[model samples]
Target: MASIRISCLLMGLLTVFLGTEVHSYAASFGSLAHTASATATTTTRSVTTTTRVVRKRTWATQSSNKAFNINMLDMCHRYGYNVDGQFVVPEFMKLLNALNRAQCHMASEILYPRDYCLSIKDEDKVDLIVIGSGTAGSLLAAKLSDNRDLKVLLLEAGNLPLMTSEIPGLWADSIGTEMDWKYFAVADETFGQSLDGKKVNVIRGKCLGGTTAMNNMLYDRGLEKDYLYLESIGLTKWGWKYALKLYKKSEDCKFEKITTSKTVKNFHSQGGKVSVDSFRNTRTLGIRQSFSKAISSSNLKTVDYFDVKNHRGFVSSIAMIKNGLRLNAARAFLTDANRKYNLRVALKSTAKRLLFEDNKVVGVEFENSIGELIKVRVTEGVVLSAGPIGSPQLLLQSGIGPKSLLNSLAIPEVAVNERVGSNLQAHASFLGMIVSFETQPLKAYSISEMVYEYLLKQSGPLANIGLSSFTGFIDVNEDGTPDVQIHFYYYSEDDTVFMPSQLDAFNFNDNITEQIIDINENNDMEIVGISLLHPTNSGNVIIEKTDNGYKPVIKYGSLHEDDVTTLLKAIEWFKKVLTSEAFEKYGPKIVPLKIAGGPEPNVDSEEYWKYAIKHLTTMNVQMAGTCSIALNPSEGVVNQNLKVFGVENLWVADSSVIPRIFSTESSAPTLFVAEKANDIIKNQLGCKGSNESNEDDDENENN
Candidate 1:
């Protein structure tokens, strides 16, 4: 019905333009012409004649000053609303109106404009209520609401995705914006010196798509062992054999270039919501080729890392980008079709606490957009997908955590689960590797050219996120499993000197910003870093009661001795790649490692490397295992079913339930968990939803 309205509006505008006289219109409109051929129909008896014209137009001038004209042209192309023949005043006005509406739809979000949930009465109740419109929440909400009979409510703390956030390359621009939660991890005393001995910023998307809308867009399903470890720990349903199916169910791999590997072909899926693809531009291709060659020359084979069976190799990084825009989880799952009926989404709604009747969750108390406290009842169940940090905090605030912690905060304990915030894990990283190259004038046009290219064609350097093209998963134990993950970042000659505003989403500190500027002043640079995929050391997420509300106290680091040794090996492997013959021509140089209260370390010394490991270790931002899934209440807050150990009808479907940090970025794995949890919840609820019509349900049931 919405599509019909758009088509009718477009057609009404096109008809008005085609009805005008050609010569006079072209003269007044400043060289506007239509290319489509016109056909005349005549009736013999009445001598009535009609002319049907198809409209088309081309740019008469090549000036960049034509903002209005360029934008209109871009909108027409983007929406496939072709204007074929002769332009007129009415048609022009209609085109302007259409463009304005599209722009407003992309730029603005419905916050408190009109409260959709306000109409619900005290007696009214939904079948399912999902908190947090993030990665897991969005997908689960969409799937659960597919059944027309089911009433599903989804709540988001932030508003919709902005037009700026939709741009793939402008990811960093949203870092400190209203879209991000902007939480910080407490500075690690041992390995957090590189962050200027200050708290490391942890960015989480507050909007509908969650972190999927803000992350680096790297699409990776961690090693098979990561999930197998979960199965070994009592989560028998989470092994790779079962988890891979969920991954395939959510992914729609529509890459331009496919790898020539049977395993990769079998692994990747098509016709799903999320788009998975590799960088295909010339610049990105060159970087990928060079990085792969370097890794290969260093005694590592180049293979498609997406293949779970053979993941140890260098390959071009895959991303959740489609047509140069971020295909976030919200866009992927919560489509217009899905939201048409049976689904109510509330934006800018923050959950204050969970409502419990004895041991079971009955509803949730939340603050609406205008700060009005509203309680929504749930008939079936409540799923808390409020991300790793928010999930545990909500649980603690609702008196579902440690008894001692609840008593300290003067909150009445509902359930004393000591492991609510323990078992926190994140990939430990060191971003000290910097390879400089001779400056080259790569582009013929100015920076404006790049911007225009992105605006008009959605191509050029701005198309890609500019993080890197290649990545490698390497084994440290000489076994088949990989313990270290490497990411290769490339910077153009201009990018190093004056950093682009688009990269602000990273929220780098002043020191790192200055370092980047200093390194790129005269030459282009490549920054490569390795992360310990399976760190034995873990951390905790504690809730410290504050004057306003509860703030998370994130205590994490590479503190384990095995973690240090593994990182040392990862650093050695990276150094080997840098010293390879393929990278020799680029004049690879390691940037001096700087620590807060120490001098620059000697690059070749083992003691210096260890110092770097201790002082320079950073969080990869792939946090998980806060509310780990385990059989014992002492070991985990959630059980194998992703439900809280002591709470009934309360489930956590986010990254917090992952028992361990995976060997790859947590985005894909997080998505996979969401997909799998949807089924788990549906089965537990015994509701035959519309998702059963899909092949995924059948495959999952069989598994």
Candidate 2:
């Protein structure tokens, strides 16, 4: 009884740390005799008494000892909890290992009351089929299934998200993990040639929540002008007003600053699916504030980026985080939907091709986890929300692309639409700039200490990227329009874990990685990531059938001269920031990395900056434009309603429909698109309470 009580107490604590998933199991063990004694001790040392209780009340149970053991093992491996015996005790380690070897299901029974997936028969038919349980698909499927009469099937290529994905700061660590699709850009001499193997990695989350599960959770709605450009380019109804309505409908803004700010109060809304909040407590708060101060000192206005009136300014970012955990699309939208009998989620199921009959998509063929092909027919329609890369690749697999390209691949052309895989645009940035500070403003904690703080209080350096939250949108062209988005990353001395992911994400060469590691080892460093909001060049995605499956071959355009100039201007803007009064006290200075086998140009010269920018250019993975939206079939793949031109009951709802690249991250915009798609889908299905857009509603509204 004593041993069971002790083990159960540990499991309870694990529940508290692991977020809402297994939180109920922890509460269930609150009745144990030993829990009271351990609770005070753990709470006093790691978490505030109030925070622990509040989290307990907010979360419910769903887990087992096996789940606990595995997740604990994951935590140990992921965050260096067992590194150098930092936080490990010999007896406690033995208990964990024993639990790992034991079979336990009762905790899981309580934690997860029911399985989310519903097994479907091979020839089964549903009212609607939604491919890809990504940011868009998750919400779209959830909303579609809300009508009890309609049956919705959501197929995901990957399984459910892991417990580690809940931690906000660990988002980067998942770049090359199992949860990521791990798509690498095909080698190009003219693009990303300086990087390792002349390749740049494209990150797409393979799990249920999709990229939202593995991404930096910054919720940027993009500039109002970006939407106007969409409207001008034939996406007539996707203007600022319609877009904002969808944005507010999907967002549940929890950011006190934004909610309270009179300037942007009306811009945000309450009680929506996606919870948006500010990083309320961060270890490097001082550094973030100092950088914001530096922006003001540089003569740039510091205002809420959410406010469209002052859209271009410096401010700490608002993220899709709730209660210190990552609230991904699945968590926010699909969790409750799991209980709905009308929705069936097929996890680890890859959609092979769309089954088309006379220009109508009637069904879909997918490969299940055990390598079996299953065909499911759709009665109402099929929506492809498989992201820009996946959706276009799938379309090409089903022979809906350029005829010449399809013929080259020996694929039977189902629908010849020349624009199926063209117009790929992504936000590229220069990661070579390193800013050094003489003294560190925040005290660095050991891995064990940081882990404890994260597990207990859910507040610390591990809780959020400190200086990274503070970003600036600067007007590089001096036209009063922001041209670049500046992202800042602070690395404390001797950080062994963080740099690997950063290097791997950009696929930086060994020489550059070594230089960065060396600089980080000696000095408190800030990596200046200057991202071009709009680029002159565009790329395309093509499919190459492999023994395993279809692989997307991204043909990114060569770097344009205008794009390079924009980055150069951004670097100049950053120079002003470093020299500002706020940074003077910290003695901030630029530390340039040597290019591998390049001309020895003066570091201060334009030629050197241009060379560096070219060598270091990489992407933010805000990929879009494939399967673009247009007024007609001659112009693009999809129409204003996001319906595929040549097919009936077929639509594309992901970032692939964005006709042009925008000035911010794509997640929030993707959610907005999904919200609009949901209403459109619901209205088509004759579902009650559908908030379909009215073109006349925005007629009297100001632009």
Q: Which tens-of-lDDT digit does each residue in 1-703 have in candidate 1? A: 3334333333332332332222332232232323221232321111233432211111111121133233555434333322444435455455456544653443332111223645544445788889887779988988877666678888888887654566666566567678888787887766656553355667788987888887778888876677678878777778776776778788888774553544455566888888888755565554455667877754677664455556788777788888777778887787663335678888888888888889888998887777778888888889999988899989998998988899999877889988888888888776666667653323322333344355445677657766454677888767668888887556655451124342232334445545554565456776677778877778888888788677888888446887788777877777777676666556767776454556565667777777766655677768898888888888888877778888788989999898887878788888888887888787777766523212333332221
What is the per-residue lDDT of model 2 for residues 1-703, given as tens digits with 9 covering 90 to 100? Answer: 2234334534543444343322222222232211111122111112233322111111113233335545656644443334253554454555445443331321221111123344676889899999998889989888888889999899898876655566677667677788999888776554575787778888898987899988888888888788779877866678878877788777899887778876575777899888999877556667766776877755766554455546677787889887677778887887676478888888888999999888889999998888889999988999999999999999999889999999998988888899998999988888878887788766765443444465445677657867777788888898888888988877766554355455567778756765676676557887889988887888899988788867889877667888888888888877877787777777787988888776563547787788787788888879899988888777789887788888889989999998887788899889878888887888876788776874556332342
TM-score of each: 0.80, 0.84
RMSD versus native structure for model 2: 10.3
What value of lDDT does candidate 1 attain over all alpha carbons?
Answer: 0.68
Model 2: lDDT equals: 0.74
Q: Where does candidate 2 stray beyond 4 Å?
A: 1-118, 695-703
